[model samples]
Target chain A: MTDTRMATDAAATWHARLDSPDMDWEDFGRWLDADPSHRAAYDAIAVLDAEIGERAAAIAALLPANDDEVAVPASDAGVPDAGSASRGTRWRWAAIGTSGALAAGLALLLVAPSNDGAAQVYATGRSETRSVTLDDGSRMQIDRGSRVSVTGGGTPVIEIAQGAASFAVRHDPSRVLMVRAGGYEVRDVGTRFDVVSARGRVAITVAQGMVSVVPSGGAIGDATMLNAGQSLTITPDKQIAIRGRIDPARVADWTDGRLDYDGAPLTLVAADISRYADSPLVVDPSAADLRFSGVLTIGDGSRLVDQLRAVLPIRARRVAGVVHLDAAGPR
Target chain B: MLAANRHQLVRFFTGRTGSVAEAEDVVQEIWLHVGQPPKADGVTGEPGAGPIANPLAYLHRVGMNIVLDRVRANGRRQRRDAGYVDATTSTVGAEAIDDAPSAFDAVADKERMARLTTALTGPPEGAMRVFRRHRIDGASHAEIAAEFGISRSAVEKHIAVALRHLRKALDD
Candidate 1:
């Protein structure tokens, strides 16, 4: 066979193996690296494969139906219509909703607090991170799938309803900033910190300065002071609060699309990944105590579980659109 | 594993793309696809489920696919630019000069669609059906094979044949 023909066949074989779990990626890489023409051949095949998918609906409309095969009922859920114009319209609406939410987020930052002291709620969509600068110049970077309500004008009371956020409060002894999550309050005169409130648990990581953590109605004298590089976590059932050391630089790294964990619980990692995940991610009880210490790049939020699987001895299985992370069995 | 071998992946991509910056961009894209959802429905096996025999080689393969995607995009952009220049020079006094690019794109898309339609008809018997079932209908290879009363490899061959024909048609 001609070199071009041989490369084309090899490229086709590699493309076919793309969906295989046991795919030999290293061998495939070597094949591509062996000759530059091999790369060109593989590129054409791969791009064509993707184009076929992109134009699937259009192509389906053009082609004759598979009359001999059993036709899948249209009412079946999760199965997209092979030739539906509605799919296009749904995508258009999705695009509009994304931009609309972004515009609303910007407007929320500019709007002045109401005189009535009514709390204004701010929320971020799945896979979206938002930064808000309050009137007092204290900035809060809200993580994906999070909600925070702001009340009070000069001395704002920020409440995290769900998910995580990082704060850089302007140091002002005269005006104290209060952050509430899961019935616990963080009082700051001036500091940078991260608060994650989910699953009835609250974790506060202090990157810079000092912050006092106390119950909502607790007195200041009884509050626990968390200094820079210290993290505090309050368990849901026991209400037992534990303090630990953390890298000051890694606090709120999610704002930069990186999840830097230092021996964090698997449950906590799953909770963070759930923010960007399309389906609910449940951690198996057996894997509850597993701790993860690594840096994961959150690009579009799809591969977080994959990255976790690579480092941790965990396997993810999707059932009814929900992903479950379980400890791997002995091979 | 990806975190530990990130530097090596960058080096591999840099060697191929010839620029550290571009290599980093490709590596970033690889991270996105590393834990991607399984392509076939009801397929429980994860890509990196077990210990990879050669992790660096696996990463390099992922990087290669991303580089190919970038190359393909560049090729498409160049083709579009050449078409735009051709249309502008050939039709100096044409109406709606401002809409030339969009018009040209529409024409190109229409031509490609027609070619694909013609190519679909030219594939060998049953190849088109298998391709449509898997690609257009999103059926797994196992599902398509069962429907056709054929082996999984046969289903794959049909797909490869259909793809080869389609690629040739588009090239023309």
Candidate 2:
């Protein structure tokens, strides 16, 4: 076979294998890194596969169906009749249109912020993350279990009631957007920043522009100007610390359903996950201080414990509706 | 053991099938095959039978077989559907047309469906069968190989050919 043909076939095989229940991810990673063409080919097939699957029913209906074929039970075949099929087609197209509108809304949220008193309150459930368009046209992606109320008139103000929220604030010299996250306030001159308030701690990370972090009732002298790629952590004990050179890419990783950490305390990991899970995840005193580094992909939340167990000398179990993580004993 | 791997298997198949909902059905089918002993007397004498040395590998093998079988079934369906279309179009003047797709259907949906139909119709019969069994009916490659009296590698080649054809047709 020609090299290209070989690569394509290999990519297809790998794609199927990766989906296999017993796939070894490490092996797959090795194969992916072996050849650049392999990754490209695999990506091509994956994208096409998704597109076709998304329209699988419509495509199946478009095929000429025999009287006998109709009896063949493909329950997912949504196009059983002309009338209902038309409805399905309309719904699909409507969804496509909504996504287009979302794109436009996203553009406006980034480029424009109008100061008008359009009060909007956005909140997310334990398992929900919501993106809101403020009256000023700025956008905020509220994390799971987070609540934020926005007032868009003259110097728009956002009150982060609880949990984490990321802002893509539009630059306006005439007005400054102020975010009241717990006792700390983040005043955006024209910037993108994330405020995470959890576990008696508040963290502010900037992705772009500059923001000043000030105490709720303190003088401007105490205010600290944080530029792009900076992070500030405030504890309940009133200790404020700043960490520079924050990887901007990691600022809002949670929005993508991933928790990216590098040498972070397992206690904090458990705390972050507790926001989404039904039961609180408790780290035993010994395991609490142990640090872990990895990307935990959020699914059903059980994977977090599984991954933690895999790399650490730890054990996780559900006891009385609470998840507990403790140091493991050797067999 | 199967229950523990259920989510992982679903995630795996989701990548291939592109829909988690569809992938759930595929994973469930794998579980059924695993739970069945493949014997009336419950004897464990068959080759590689009894205790399933590695459940993950077993699940993987069975899942692949299911995909291959699905490919074969889809190929048969395509041929049958094609014949039905041909007969109807040929008898247009002689026979009263029935169940003809309405022209009022959404044009974009129709166009996409047309591309898929065209893609499914053109591959070689054997390759198409293998492809359909796996891709459409969720048959595993192993089962397809066994049913067709061919090596597993041959089945893979057939599927690869079908995939290439579908990819090319859809890309166009």
Model 1: residue A139 alpha-carbon error in angstroms: 0.9
> Per-residue error at A229 for model 1, in Å?
0.5
Q: Encode model 1's per-residue lDDT on B46-137: one tens digit a residue.
A: 23222333444445555665575466557655765676423332221222222224565578778887787677666454666677677667
My TM-score estimates for the predictions, one after another, are: 0.41, 0.41
- Give the CAPRI rating of model 2: incorrect
Q: Tens digits of per-residue lDDT for model 1 on A77-179?
A: 1212111111222111223324323222211121122211335568988778899987556999998888997765445778898988899987433334678
In model 1, the Cα lDDT at residue A276 comes to 75
lDDT tens digits, residues B91-120, model 2?
Answer: 222233223333543464467667776776
Q: List model 2 lDDT by residue over A161-223, tens digit each.
A: 778889887643223477887688777744678988876677888888767677887654456
The all-Cα superposition gives candidate 2 an RMSD in Å to the true structure of 25.1
Candidate 1 residue spans exceeding 4 A from truth: A1-118, A278-280, A318-322, B1-172
* Model 2 per-residue lDDT at A224: 66
Error of 1 at A177 (Å): 0.5
- lDDT of every model, 2 decimals: 0.66, 0.58
What's the TM-score of chain A alone for every prediction?
A: 0.61, 0.59
Collision pairs in model 1? none
